[model samples]
Target: MEEKKSKFPKWLKISLIVIFVVGLFIGWKAYQTFMGASVTDKEEYLYINSGDSYEQVFAKIKSLDIVKHPNLFDYAAKAMDYKDIKPGRYKLTPGMNNRRLIGNLRGGYQEAVKFRFENIRLKESFAGLLGKNFEADSTAFSAILNSEEIAKQYGFTKDNFFSMFIPNTYEIYWNTSPDKMMARFHDEYTKFWNAERTEKAKALDMTTQQVSILASIVKGEALHVDEMPAIAGLYINRLRKGMLLQADPTVIFANNDFEIRRVLNRHLTIDNPYNTYRYKGLPPGPIMMPSIAAIDAVLNYQHHNYIYMCAKDDFSGYHAFATNVAEHQVNARKFQKALTDRNIMK
Candidate 1:
């Protein structure tokens, strides 16, 4: 090595030094481009909508203000041949480098969103909720919900279409379509009404829809889950005895005035079919979307001689049950007195 150095010219030594410097610079640049901190925050999200172009997706990423070196990201993305940007909700976590972020986008590794609905009282409200969660708008969802022809394809009428949806939290992509959402609900409804549940409904002499209808009433009556079965039994007894359901929730629904804290004698006179006090049988449909617990309560209703239920006067969200008119009237009077004392006259 000493002999070679002796033979080497000064220019050659300078050239070698220059080459080493250039190589080091190139290596550093490559490292920065490939493994640098791209996501500047602990977490970020990117929503690429349907039919979004690559430029549009890049714009959305820029708008998030999470990218530390957007130019490097652009160069890396182009070099990796990432032309197609999949539409979905993408979550970018901390310590993600440029290469990792690009890989996630190129591979369409999106995060699923939680979609949940319970105690939804109106089809319109349910539609709005679904629209907010997915790409479909409220009008689009409402159209499908109101269409008898479309509902019939799933073995449901427009009036009873709500029965097809079971209340639960579902993990789904944010871009799910309305039609797909409806199909999913139908599949879930079919799976929920399995042999065991169906057999139980049969024993009760009720159809799946009938169970849902009664479940809605039970849910409206009972604020406490423990009382659901008792409320279901009371309603069942009333149904069997050819008595009016006399459910105040149904009366409130019929009036379309949820603000009426006290269901007065005037509210019961509403001519809407949802008023159980006026209607002989179950309402034209469920006044509200019933939960799985409420539905099961109807299927496994407690056997008892109690044919009446009045909300407890203590306002403890419990009810008092009675076997006859005298006891029921006494319970009703106590509750009425409590309401009057509170000056909740409506």
Candidate 2:
């Protein structure tokens, strides 16, 4: 015979079990509602405009859909007193809880925007690029960039100030002022022109600005990096001979038209000082932003007697060097024929 078992009330046992299950469900829901993952798993970003209020920031956040539970986020924000909004680019990641997200927005913990610019041709275009990347408007950037007084304040002329910004990967704040941006550019420019580089420019009897100008032309002409030194050397030879640069790229720049693929005889007749065919020296300024390789090529140009260059007959993008104009003409005919066959006529 089994020992007699004491029986509890069925209603009481069922009540206890119900209470235990309800307690666990409540605890889990509270944890998730308060401190669980609020941000989404997908890679998303939120850009807060300057002068945005907390409500405006919230609106933008909701628009981005980076948060999983907006109601939970709102409660967390209220509890944490996250009322202040800091303007910047916020890189949202997965596994970010409400506290972390709110703290990131409130404390201005922003990710630096990595801006790697292309070989820009105009300041207007550059300003637009900055506008797209930063919190500032394009008009604001353009106003300061084009201002002569501002340029002079930074020890640069209006014409040559464009060279201050080296085309490279720059990590900068999204809310940087135009003045501060220029200051940073100047600082970078100073750092780039180290003692050795300055001495190299001095030995070449050229200022850094002049070197940049020439580098821009070299960048314009040479499609391949390896060809830069030779093209630079050829330009130096032309300069020594007091011959006009006659660079087709410069002619294209002079016409204020970047669409001209083939530099025609008519394009060379432009009276602008930037037209190297009409002008005897480097243009009033750079035709475009020069690459570091092109600038270094100018500083360390090859020593050669070759004075002329033409693109190779094929699609190699390499130029054929010639010590004499006749040889240059022969190479030019080959390239021209190739161009004609390819229907690149402008």
Clashes of each: 0, 0
Model 2, range 1-346, lDDT digits (tens) per residue?
9987658778989999999999999887777766787788655677888898988877766777778877778777898898777888888888788788888888999999888986898899999999898888899999987888987887777777787778889999998877788788889899998999889989888888888999999999999899899999999999989999888888888898899877789898879989988889888778888889999999999999998888898878898999998999999999999889999998
Per-candidate local distance difference test: 0.88, 0.86
lDDT (Cα, 0-100) at 326 in candidate 1: 100
List, residue by residue over 1-346, the lDDT tens digit for candidate 1.
5545567789999999999999999988888888877787834677789899999878866777667777888888898898987888888876678899889888989888888889899999998988887876899999999999998999878888888899998888888888887888888899999999999999989889989999998998888999899999989999999999999888988899888888888887878888888889899788899989999999999999998888899999999999999999999999999999999898
Candidate with best lDDT:
1
The all-Cα superposition gives candidate 2 an RMSD in Å to the true structure of 3.2
Candidate 2: regions farther than 4 A off: 1-26, 41-43
* Angstrom error at residue 306, model 2: 1.8
Taking all chains together, each candidate's TM-score versus the true structure is 0.94, 0.89
Count of clashing pairs, candidate 1? 0
Model 1 is weakest, by summed lDDT over 10 consecutive residues, at 1-10
